[model samples]
Target: MSWVILIVSGVLEAVWATALGKSEGFTKLWPTVILGVALVASMGGLALAMRDISTGTAYAVWVGIGAALTVAYAMIFGGEPTSIVKVLLLLGLVGCVVGLKLVDTSH
Candidate 1:
């Protein structure tokens, strides 16, 4: 389903973003290669999802999910700060994604 593809694409976006961070300015060869492959795969999945979903809505959801997941990953593994404000912001991002899905499905 298009929604499934979109979700997968969003997750891949998280993976690629983490890979990019690990690539150390692209000086690390393996992580950089992983980042490139994940980026391509995520984009391809997004293109497929766009065949059925509205571009504006799908893009917003995709980016929202990607950003939230990336931030969570960074906080958990990359020693990034996990303040209360950041947690609330991530929750708000999740709420936006849920709201978009609800509106999209109700149509």
Candidate 2:
């Protein structure tokens, strides 16, 4: 359950990150609202997950998921450049996240 929440929080991180980019320094109304909401939700979920998961592992996983998704989103829709190296790097981040989960002995 905590893992689930953590994963969701990580996704929310991506949501907030993307929304922030669209917020235009908080001048935009809708995107700013979305960013605020998603930021709070993501942090809340992260805090909840930390009740069960180790801080370091949880943080790493959260960052990994958020970063990978954010870059993927940008590349896919926001005119960010794409290349094999970027893909491989994202894959490596995912691999590290998975490895952390596998090696985690605590619940």
Tens digit of per-residue lDDT, candidate 2, span 1-107 = 98999999999999999999999999999999999999999999999999999999999999999999999999999999999999999999999999999998777
**What C-alpha lDDT, on a 0 to 100 scale, does residue 57 get in candidate 2?**
94
Name the top TM-score candidate: 2
Regions of candidate 1 where Cα sits further than 4 Å from its true position: 105-107
The CA lDDT of each predicted structure is 0.92, 0.97
lDDT of 2: 0.97
With a 3 Å backbone cut-off (N, CA, C), the pairs that clash in candidate 1 are none
The clash count of every prediction, one per candidate, is 0, 0
Task: Compute the lDDT of residue 67 as modeled in candidate 1.
Answer: 94
Candidate 2: which pairs clash?
Answer: none
